[model samples]
Target: MSRPHSVVSQVPSGVLVVDKAPDMTSHDVVAIARRALGTKKIGHCGTLDPMATGLLMLVVERATKIQDLLMSEDKEYEGTLTLGVTTSTQDRQGEPLEEKEVRSFAPEEIDAAFGVFKGEFEQIPPMVSAIKKDGVPLYKLARKGQEVARDPRPVHVTKYEIRDIALPEVTFSVDCSKGFYVRTYAHDIGQHLGCGAHLSALRRVRSGKFTLERAVTIDMLKTAPREDLYKAMISLAEISLMRGA
Candidate 1:
């Protein structure tokens, strides 16, 4: 008789939130988690571009069942954008395509530009993105210098607070729905102000009910003993309790 999958499984089910460091792909964190947790059934809630850092939630074992559901909720982030350049990827990781003189855009002017995107709108996904086209990732096409038409996706930004406005670099926090691209938000704001722009830095701070306060650092994930890692897990029961509340 064939054995059932869970009968042979050894790991518990829960969510593992990691404070992902900059320059690490979300999948790279997953690989480290898989090894640290000793299970191949782990999956992250969403992808965080390699250049961006912060909370990345991983679903383990049976928790993977709710991955898509968890991924569909709103998220919060803090990011910095430089107003003098536009990049191919809409972020710092891509090639710089254009540069402009960043004249002193007054705080009121900057606020007005950001105000244009305060609510729901259409956003064209950048070419250097993981979104697929005919079974190929757009980033692969972007690597070959190929461009393709992408439909505008509807996204909503519930809250955007400017934390600092230091001329060319603006730092801010935003609460936006799933699939909202902060890089694109910056680029469009630049376009509005006629200065061009690109995302210089980004850090995810929250996703739905989960926050970075409950996250483990990437270093701990890399070197912690398996038992220690298990203790860090947010049990499936806890997750249920969170969702119910």
Candidate 2:
């Protein structure tokens, strides 16, 4: 399927908040935006794992210039942490590294573990991440059964609340600084609890001032007319207002 050449050039330059569907990479969503919005200048501010779904910010044309600034904003996510199992990728997307029987723990014990990670602390970035070493992404090395030394970096868990707990599964919400990885957080929490754990599911609810409420789904863009799609884009001026909000 191809977009009209004339329409492509005429498409507005701005940000479009997308409620990204699970199993689609951030780049995949960008490709869809290109076709639906008739613009090849589309880019996303953040990378969401294929297993993740939620608000993904796409910048078009001139809006791409502020991509770095948008990426610097804090992020909020709600996800499930599954205990008693660990994965190479720290999420459900990877092979199982280890598994253990989950022992019953008091609610306060779980709360105390959460408190240990709150505020400012250092965390080792996971091997499954896009962080690069010698210009090659770490995930590439990970896929080849290679492991390398990585230094711990600082991350702040401003808000880490347990929304619910159902034995091996714990639903939680977190608001954290830029560059924080929720996958690593889940993995570390399990280590603290003496039971292996990994991120089972994730959904980004907020990125800076952009909320899931204002996000349009891929289906919406696919089914809507070009004119209606253009109306859904957030202007550069509005993004500037997000700084104040």
Candidate 3:
């Protein structure tokens, strides 16, 4: 027998807010949200590594229109840097290539180190990233043990504040325009300090006007009913109006 009309009519449409968990890629979240909503019109604004967590913006059905605008917006993150170690990837996932005994620094010294990174500057993205080169992803080439020169692109770090100066870790907040690579920023700063550093943990707190405050965990999203799924997704026009205004 054919399905009831009420069932077809009951599907709601909107945006979904996901508090991405550590170790789960952003694409994994989209797949789960797609199955949860029972529709194919689900998409995410930007990519986040599996090691990172916090705000991961998603759109459902009509809301998918907003992804472009959201992708171009400023981002805010709280991250921790591991000193005395340098990694190939500039993040904890990579193998450590060098280790040095680090000298602990005062808050003022930490601030000064990052002050050089703030404002507009050119940045070269790490090889183990999604950025493409000559029609192939750089990460693909990197995995094959090949290296290539990458042009530095201009990026702006509006705010780079040292929030804590714990012995081995430096916790901080970084606010930047679109296209900024916090990983490269950390690596270069480490090089400048003469102790080397790598990103240990990162959590995106804000993207444009959408904050982690409104994000729900993946588990919570997985348990939500199909009809309720689309109801949670917000539209691009809505985000544009909210962020642009």
Q: What CA RMSD would you report for each candidate?
A: 4.8, 2.0, 3.4
Across 6-83, the per-residue lDDT of candidate 2 in tens digits comes to: 344487888889999999899999898888887788899889999999999999989988899899889999999999
Question: Highest lDDT, which number?
Answer: 1
Per-model TM-score versus the true fold: 0.95, 0.95, 0.91
Give each model's clash number: 0, 0, 6
What is the Cα-based TM-score of model 1? 0.95
Where model 2 places Cα greater than 4 Å from the true spot, the runs are 1-9
Distance (Å) between predicted and true CA of 13, model 2?
1.8
lDDT of all predictions: 0.91, 0.89, 0.81
lDDT of 3 by residue, 40-128 (tens): 88798778888989888887777666578668989998899888899989999999999999886776777788998988899988998
What TM-score, to 2 decimals, does candidate 2 have? Answer: 0.95
Q: Which is better, 1 or 2, measured by lDDT?
A: 1
lDDT of 1 by residue, 46-128 (tens): 79999999999999999999999999999999999999999999998888989999998789999888889988888999887
